[model samples]
Target: MDETVTAVIDDVVARAAAHDADEPDRLRRWRVLEPDAGRLLWFLVQSSGARDVVEIGTSHGVSTLWLADAVRSTGGHLSSVDADPDVQDAALANLVRAGLDAHVTFGTGDGGAALAGLDEQSVDLLFLDAERTEYPGWWPHPVRVLRPGGVLVVDNAFSHADEVAPLAALIDEHPGLTSTTVAVGKGELLALRSR
Candidate 1:
């Protein structure tokens, strides 16, 4: 990322941190990804040439800004979904401020339902930072929409391991994907969809 872009991202993150802290109740379950994790998300997307990415959570668009940096380069787009209208609106405003609005599409609703609505094999990357335990039930949608060799990233495996253990186990046991957990921010479960 360029210096100008980096500055924009930093400013946005700082603002989001304050906003989240103030209204903890409203955005409690929908926490922002750690700065370390945000950097990694940007690296993964930038390195992988993933054009079409779907993020399960978009709290104030902190993570989305990172993804957008890479998507902007590839001329691709990112679609992010969250259940709260207020949260979604906040994210949209943040994106606009960051000058990343052109690379993203914000949606309001369940992540699973949003993923199910996408075309099959259309997504190059699927990122989950929402409910970790419910990951299993939503597998089919990502599995169907994620292109072969596409990557799926699940956050909170280390920070909230017990809660996300079922998801890790299933990913490890699944036949169509290969996964490994990296010690990035909070630990990220990175998997590649194999045909």
Candidate 2:
């Protein structure tokens, strides 16, 4: 990462850590994105000039906050989905505290189904951080909704490499996308549309 970007990520992590410390319940339930992972996500959004980002999971809004901040900087918007209402409520509070409420929209329901309902070619950035084992099932719909040249970021792709193998294979078979696996936080697979 560039020095300026590194500094920004450090600041974001410091803020997130402080917030997490202030809320023990949230800290217990959600793992805030490590500095590097947060930086990567921020970089992706800025690089892509993404105006509409979709996130499949919003645990305690840690990643949500990170993405929202990046989107706000770019004058973009974020829509996140999570099945747990409690988690969504907590995430909402976190986003509010972060002053990122204006940039975010939260949906409560099955992530896959929620994503499927979105209009095609509507999202600029799609992030998957939900159940690892359900990645394949959750991935296709998001890809379908992404516009040509959109980016898909899948978290825990390396940690759950076995579970993600099929998805990886599919990506490998597809000529329209290119992916890179990074060992950030848990692990992240970033697939950018090449078509």
Each prediction's RMSD over C-alphas, in Å, is 1.9, 4.4
lDDT of each: 0.83, 0.79
Candidate 2, 1-195: lDDT as tens digits: 234434444555666677677676743545556666777888889888999999988877768877988898889999999888887897787676667789999999888898889998899999888776676676667678888999988887777788778777777777778888989987998888866
Name the candidate that leads on lDDT.
Answer: 1
TM-score of each: 0.91, 0.83
Error of 1 at 100 (Å): 1.0
- Put down candidate 1 lDDT per residue, 1-195, tens digits, no spaces: 766567776877677678667774743644777778888888888888899999998876778888988899888899999887787787787777778888988889888889879999999999998877677788777678889989999888799999888777877877998998989888998989997
Candidate 2: regions farther than 4 A off? 1-28
Candidate 2's displacement at residue 71, Å, is: 0.8
- Cα lDDT of candidate 2 equals 0.79
